[model samples]
Every structure is written in C-alpha cells, then in structure tokens.
Target: EEEHTSCEIPRDAIDVCGVQDPDDVSLDNVKEVLDSIKVLFEEDKTIKAYRLWKKLEGLVGQYEEAPQEQELSDKLMNAKELITESMFMLNQVTMEAESVFALLEELDSEEGWELAKDEAGIRTWFKQPEGSPTYHIKIQGTIKSPIFDVLALVNEVDLYQKWIPTCDLSKAVLNISKFKRMIQLCMTPPSPVNWVVSRRELMLYGYGVDMMEDNKMIAMAKSPSPGE
Candidate 1:
C-alpha cells in the first residue's frame, strides 16, 4: 500500500473552479493547472505562488468532492500542500517588511522613509514628504565626554572655529535666552549647499523638559518644510 498524503483544496483553487465555463471543466485540465502551480511554488517565486494559489483555490472547489477521478484527486492533494507552503512564506515576508518600516519610523517622526546608508558613528535617514523632491533628514548619535564640558563648548558660539573642526566661523545672531538662539555658521570647505544660518533650539534634559529622564542635551536646527 502506498502512503497517502491527505490535503484539502485551497480556497483560491475553489474560486477558480466556480468561475470556469461549465463546458470547460475536465479532470485532465484541472490536474494540469495544479501541476503548474506546484512548479511555481517549487521555483521559490512567492509572489507567483500566491497568485497561482488564489487561482487554484477558486477552481479546486468544483472538483473537491468529485471522488471519481483518482488521478485528479492525487494532483489536488499535492497542490494543497504546495499552496500551504507558499502562503506561509508570503506571510513571513510581510511581517519582516512591517517590522523594518516601524523601526525606520521610530528613528524619524516622518513616514515613507527608506534606509539610504549608514557608516561610522553617524546614522542618516531621510524621507520625501508628500511626493516632493525635497527630503527631510534626521541624524542621531552619542558622543562620550563630560556632559557639562561638552555643553559649555557647544554653547560658546564665538569659539566654534577653535573646536568645531569643520567650522570656519560661527557668530551668534541673537541670544534668545539660555534655551534658544540663532547662529550664523560658515564651513571650512564651504559649498553652496553646506552654508546655513539657522535658528537653534537647545533643550537641557534635567532643567525644564519632562521628557528627558537623564541629564542629556538635545540640539535641533530649524529648517523650512519640505518642498519649500
């Protein structure tokens, strides 16, 4: 006695069977269709497998209870096994894609982002908002140093050129309090795109903002909205 593999007809195969012309339904043709779908699954083409599975699910229903054709019955059982495997792979791929998208969103508040590249201690992530050419960029990192010492060095605008390796000149445009200021910066190897005179917002974690649980400093440079 041969070992019998038991399998149920996939829903897509049933649907395919339902929509076919009544005159066109035949055991040989249905068997051939199932064989084709099994080949796609064996080829590791998940997308194609998913598509064929759907087609098979619709068609399989018509012959599911047809106990007359032994060959057709065997082929249908094999097709079900292949379709089940294909659907599992497709589900895994979808879950992985969603997880990566969530991580990127957590990195940047903006949505519809793709990871361009990352190297060294710096991480850069960008997104084109509203289908525009302009990209919103976010960079995050940590530097090991005495907290106060680093803050003092960063707050001294006039001393920028001395410590900021790439800065040619840094001048305070306006001192808007200890928490906010506007500064003009010129880069050492200046290019038109690298030049920026922007308003800077400084948040001292322990002093005022409730979000910062530790004594950490955050600096944000204001820029125009994307596509401006």
Candidate 2:
C-alpha cells in the first residue's frame, strides 16, 4: 500500500503560548507579544523577544540551580524537542518557527554564537538565539479519511500514537466541556537523523480533533514551542 497522505495547515493557525503566568495572561498581554514579534527582524524591538526568552530560560535555569540529579538537569536543558502539531498544522508551524529563529540568529551572532559549526569538536552546533524556537518540521500528506470518523477516533484518544507524528503517548483528561488531554512524545523523527539535540519547550501541549459528527477528522492541531 502507498504511504498515507496527510492534510495541510496554515502557519498562523497556532497559538504560541506560555503557561508560567497562565492565570495572569489577558488578551492585552497576548496582543503585545504578537505585535512586538512582527518587528523582530528589525534591529529595534528584537531585544523584546530576547528579554522574554531569557526570562523563560531563567525559570528553567532556576530549577537546574536547585540541587538535582545530574540526570534531571540534563533532561531539563537537553530536552529532546517536541513537534506538538499534527500533520494538519505542520507546515504552518515550520514557516512561523523559521521566521522567529532567523531573526534571533541574526542578533545572537552579533556577540554570542559564531553561527558556524566547529569542525574540530565532536559536538555539532545548533544556532538558536536567546529568544527563539529552535526549529520546526513540516510533514504533508492526504488521507481518503473523513472527518466524523476522525472525531470518533479522537474521542477514543488511544489511537494518536499510531498516526500523530510527534506524540509518543496520549490520554484523555477532560471529557465534554473542554476536551483536553495529555500527550508526550519523542522530539526526533521516527528515524533519527543525527544527534546534537535541542528543543523549544511548549509550556503547554495539547491536541484537538475537529469533526462534523459523521466520524472523520477534518482538522487537528497542537500548541507547543515549535522545533529546529
């Protein structure tokens, strides 16, 4: 049989979010982040994303500062990146992620990283600036599948690992009102390319299935930091 064809999605369809002050986030704060980022490629406001990204990093770093198992710290900073979006949202995430990082790389190269690999070193370099998502991958295909069936499958919540790209595990947590769930997955593709890992942690990760009661998956998406 031929490989399955997956759906396509637009890049702006995602919500780039953080849950640190989830309770405090108002529509205004979200609008500010969105507006500031548009000028990120311009020299002036680039620092805004840097500052925010560093604050986010500091939150993670503080955990590292606490006495913890070496294994734990490694896992924290060296988190394998997760591609939280489904095939429907993959391409959209990719273009958005690329735009975010390209701007950051330009700034970081000014003082920080050389943006080049060290030929002599065993470790390869991944160039992500202070405030940037490391990277994101895009996968596209078409399925003869229908949307209502997909919704029924989503109600099951046990079938994602078989088809969803980024998810390693999934389970339903909220049923009717919100339709929420928990998911975990390895960041690397089904086949690992090369090592030297990096990640943009999505403070919150979720999957949603769209349907019209006929039992097919018309659309699905995820919210997480896109990857490199």
Q: In the order shown, what is each candidate's alpha-carbon RMSD?
A: 21.7, 20.0
TM-score of 1: 0.36
Q: What does candidate 1's lDDT look like per residue over 1-228, in tens digits?
A: 845453545545534544223334344454544444433333323234445445556666766856747777777776566556555434533333333345445665645766666778777777777968888677767778987787687678789778776666777777643544667776644455345644333322111111132332234344322221
- Runs with alpha carbons beyond 4 Å of true place in candidate 2: 1-142, 165-167, 173-178, 186-220, 224-228
* lDDT agreement of model 2 with the native: 0.39
lDDT of 2 by residue, 34-142 (tens): 3233323121222333443334345455665688686766555442121112222234333433444554454344444433443443323344556877743222234
Q: TM-score: which candidate is best? A: 1
Give candidate 1 regions above 4 Å deviation: 1-110, 163-166, 187-210, 213-217, 223-228
